[model samples]
Target: MTITPQWKDELRARITLSSVIMRTDKLTKAGREWKGCCPFHDEKTPSFYVNDQKQFYHCFGCGAHGDVISWMTEQRGLSFIDAIKELAAEAGMEVPAPDPVAAKRAEKRAELIDVTTEAQDWFVEQLRGSAGREALAYLNRRGLKPETLREFGFGYSPESKQALPTALPRFEDHMLVEAGMRIRTDDGTTYDRFRGRVMLPIQDARGRVIAFGGRILENRDGVAKYLNSPDTPLFDKGRTLYNLHRASPASRQTGRVVVVEGYMDVVALAQAGIKDAVAPLGTALTEMQLEMLWRMVEVPVLCFDGDAAGQRAAMRAISRALPMLAPMRSLSIVRLPSGMDPDDLINDRGVGAMEKLLAEPKSLLDTLWEFERDAMPLESPEAKAGLKKRLMEHVDTIGDPDIQSLYRRDLLDRFSAFAYPPRQQAKRGPWRGPAAAPKTLSNGARSTLQKSMSGGQRSDLLGAVIAGLVRHPGEISRHSEALIELARHDQSAAPAIESLIELAETLDSRIQTAISAEQGFPAPPVDNRYAFLREGTPPGEAREELAEAVSLLAHKPALEAAMAATIARFDEDPEGSFAEQARLRQQLMTVDERLKAFGRKKAGSDTARDENSVSSDS
Candidate 1:
């Protein structure tokens, strides 16, 4: 039966390797993996290990390594088709019926791989021969050791257009063309695709040479400095990373992977003993490559040049990664010094600098904020608003709801600090005057003041508004100045209110919302006085209500203090104090009327809006 790559991948994903291995060998749990005696070789101690997370198994005794299907084929002595059939049966999947076209395509793919492998060998021979002296010298000048060259399968493609085809005559012209080693013009003439360049083989996760990337030895007008093979049956530059096969094992050991911009950077880092470094094959990091990176490590550090292009590349990777982000799976970013790539950094500052940079790579959130924050000038309010919009837009791309909420809160908090920084307090001199005497109150005034200070209705109203602010934490920044002033004056409710404001400043918006929900502030009073405190209120409306609440809360205390002052003046200036007291009473009445009107308007409108929403849904 002909099986497409998609079907094969689905089969592999469905079958747990440990379950299959455990049929014959007893496997013990080992951290995130399982271990057993070597299945390929007779060993007294357990050396075979299986990682279900990565879906692969390796035996330390005889260097045996493969996935579920491979285990069946190699250990059970089944052919590829029989092994896949068995696994598919066990996985409860139907094997695709044989298709002549798909079988031909599969065969063609194998042929293409063979052609590319042959071309790779030819390129390697050319690199060691007399014709490749300049290329060898170039590699030597770049400080590549001989062992590194051989290990990476570094080779050279001669400048002559026919060098590759001529050297590998065993591969038909069409086969070489399909392999991406030869370019066939529309007129039917064919020439070498990669010529006069230092060749680096781009491999699959299984270490098969799927494609080649070539860097020109000499500068030439209108020529790209580096060229990579066009997409072919065996190669997809976007889906492949330069050194993943070698880096995967290294990543397993270090629990980290460093992604660079190009193959040369990967080579440089590997030479410096950082073996877990990989790079995109002449393209930006794609979603597929990010998935591959995540499979190796929870968070892969993206190391890019510190220049503008590198920053732009990092942002591109971040954009691709955002939608794919999970709870612990994300990216860290390291920016090299300006005008330096990994190789240059390693050469100039030594490996320690690169290692240190990797060790302290910035979190994806930090890199994202820094990038968007400095993407353009924020000298104007409009620019700052633009930054906030861009940040929220990026955060919106995250598919995970929890991660999205956290990112939104984080970015918005950073934006709040940037756009509305806390006001610096003015320095004060020591007090030098005697304190003012307390004022005596009439029975009516004392009764009114005592009721207002009772901390029942008034405190509940204040708490509801504070809870509303917590629910709509983004509104806190707009009222930050007012909150600080309230914190200074309202000593009775200051601590609780101040704590909420501080939390709003730092905590994720979702967390603040969760806290408000848990606080169970009583539902809007029977009169619906605090309409904004209703669940699901719009942010704009909630902010307006919060502003009114703050004003009322602050005004009551200010009015009380003014009344005391007026009563104090009664002993000295009775006529003036009487007029001032009457004006203060009228002002307090106006505030009361405004509050009542606000509550009435919100209650009516909120009810209407809810009805409309229900009607629309219906």
Candidate 2:
């Protein structure tokens, strides 16, 4: 049955902030709030705070904050109705039937999916009979096991004109068209979508065959070698990865995911004992795909060809992974030997060789280092300076210092080491020099560079002003002029800072959200700099430190100029008094801490100790 908007809202309300806290024991009752480890992300400190009175929960670690419905949707991977039903069941209630119109639409969707499945089955059966022998032999030649064919739902489409239409009538044809299995011509003629090719079903996380990829069985001299399902309601080439459904669980268990270029590469890797592997479907890896990988594994090992294009793809993946960075999550790029893809490597050098290659995957820094080493003469000072500048630009992109340090160490090791002349040195060509020295990027320098690179003094001005306001709410009154000035300089950060000021002004108000809802995408350096502008500043402290920060803001002229710009930016919005909001936030945080401490004490000394052992930085 189809769920209505009202039903979704009702479901969301039932899973109220209090209900979620009740499910887990770590939550402790403070004066008015519940505090515990966030279920959405791995966090040691109790940053997932729930305001039962407000029916809201927020995770300071991941910035995942919402009502109970959002928690169910994100943490449990449930749709709105599904979340509602689950919560209702927990509360000993039953969900009412969906609206009739919604029910009809849902039924239609289900029918379409069923028809698509039937079409897939028919195609596979046809492959097993006449058209599939050539495809099966092709797979066998590639060392793919018979079981692999069944597991991946391999199939073949005949070159015959009526192979598909002969099996299913117009209903199936429409279904196939809707599922991206076939294309319709202007003349209304229907034909098999993938003729003379080996088919690979592309399934989503739920294992529904939404699309298909076909490798050409008989090659024409100038024709494209492969074809894929077009974008449709059920299939998104950008979002769907081949074999993700089968690979995700294995990837979670292993804590490492292997990403390849094609479906066969994924199959080959699986057959070779590397079960945690997925491939992009007829497209380069995308940010959405990377987010999926982040959910599945702590670290993803991307193996690509060593050719120029492959190296370029690796760089692209590196760029896209920046936003997903958090504690324990990492991206590693392994450049395979030239001219050999994963399948070739597995068939020739075997899984052991692949393991050895993976054992030494390149860090982003190393990839850049090699890229620089090949592009310019290291002996030239200008080249060194330019390379260092470019490298530091990327290094600064890393918000976490610990991760940045590891990259630095790896760079130093590569640059500083002088390879010894092995007994076999005589057989090799060319002599490379001793390794390069490690370069350190100062935290201050990084901040300065980030500010300068992303925008200009405007970003720094905004960051400094916001940092001051968050630490000292009283400073908002004392240095209102400065805040307005800062806000005026950076238009992008103006709204966010204005929201912070407004939140500070109203005790009854929550932090007004100005940042985009999609938080994990790559934001500009200034955007990241401004993330906590409204919430709070880093290195959080007690009332005394906040007061100190305020005092500093009261005197800092630069801060005053920045604050003035900030105020000007929000001139269009209704005036939001800051004192009341700041006071409310202070009270809430205090209450939250009290409740969290109480919960921790109740949980036991060991759990509290463990919480203290880990860093609170998300």
TM-score of each: 0.59, 0.54
lDDT, candidate 2, 1-618, per-residue tens: 444446545655655667665664378776788888876545688887888667688778645456665555444444455666778786566677778887786676676667667767977896788657777888788777888778888887777756666766656667767766667889997666777888777787768777778888767998668888888777778888888777866753564788988877888888888898898876777988886776555467899987888888887787677645643456788988999898888778889999898878887666777875576666666666666566666666766654565455545545544122235434533212113432333444334433533445443434444543443443444344434543564456555445555534432122222222132111222222222332453423323333333323222333334335544543232112121121223233333444354345436744654676674642
List of clashing residue pairs for candidate 1: none
* lDDT per model vs. reference: 0.75, 0.61
Q: Work out candidate 2's RMSD over C-alphas.
A: 16.8
Best model number under lDDT: 1
**Tens-digit lDDT track for model 1 on 92-183?**
99988768887788888888888788888888998999979999999999999999999999999888998876687787888888888888
Model 1: how far is 196 from its true place, Å?
1.1
lDDT of 2: 0.61
The alpha-carbon deviation from the true structure for residue 602 of candidate 1, after best TM-score superposition, in angstroms, is 50
